[model samples]
Target: MEYSKKTRSSPRTLDLNHIENTLSIILSQVEEPLPTITEIAEQLKINRRVLSRHFPVLCHKIVTKRRHYMRMSHLAAIEQCCQEIKEAIVSLQQSGEYPSESRVCELISNPGYFRYQQVRLLYKQELQSTLSSL
Candidate 1:
């Protein structure tokens, strides 16, 4: 956040670039392993209340963006897990092995419990569809 060591020419001089950079730093820290605003202000050598006063909009934006990003990340991970589970199920079926929950778990590395349930449901549906087509 402290972009430079040089003192500002005037205490009242509002450097928009400096403020923007500081806001960026603040937002970047909003993810997991977040630092407190007081710590951030101390690191930037500014008063916490003053920083909040100057960047209320940026603070709100950071909170919103962080929440959205976290949700997206979580959804992506869940989708990936589901895909992996499906692939594992197909592989097990091809190998003439039953795709039981334990077998599916063994086929995939560090499979999640909920994902395994989803995989079981998907495998059953696929088997039922295949049988109905026969």
Candidate 2:
């Protein structure tokens, strides 16, 4: 009987912020133009052969083309949206309620960040509108 070979687990987890900061540093080091794969991995201390495996988790692609490097932009958009949500939540604190649940439901059903194409759109509009009417 032949003994089966065991494979070792590779590097599994990396801090998201660390990876983004490394990418920023790598991008900055180049003069306006983007750096090559080797340069990015070198700055980030990530192995070029396996770096692609880690990126999809931390950075969702905003754009991609066959010849161009993939563009990831979801983080900024999500972060900005979250900040606006927090502000709306704070405003609601003074009042007893806000129409958040309904609006959120609508948003969930439709699957879009903007509600009626308004920036920082949130479900609590009904609550706010109700308060204004009183």
For each candidate in turn, the TM-score is: 0.56, 0.30
Tens digits of per-residue lDDT for model 2, 30-88:
23335555566786677764556656432222112211432233445654655555555
Runs in model 1 deviating more than 4 A are 1-21, 24-54, 113-134
Using alpha carbons, what is the TM-score of model 1? 0.56
- Candidate 2 stretches greater than 4 Å from native: 4-6, 29-33, 53-134
| Top candidate when judged by lDDT against the true structure | 1
Q: Say which candidate scores most in TM-score.
A: 1
Per-prediction RMSD in angstroms? 9.5, 13.5
| lDDT value, candidate 2, whole model | 0.50
Cα TM-score of candidate 2: 0.30
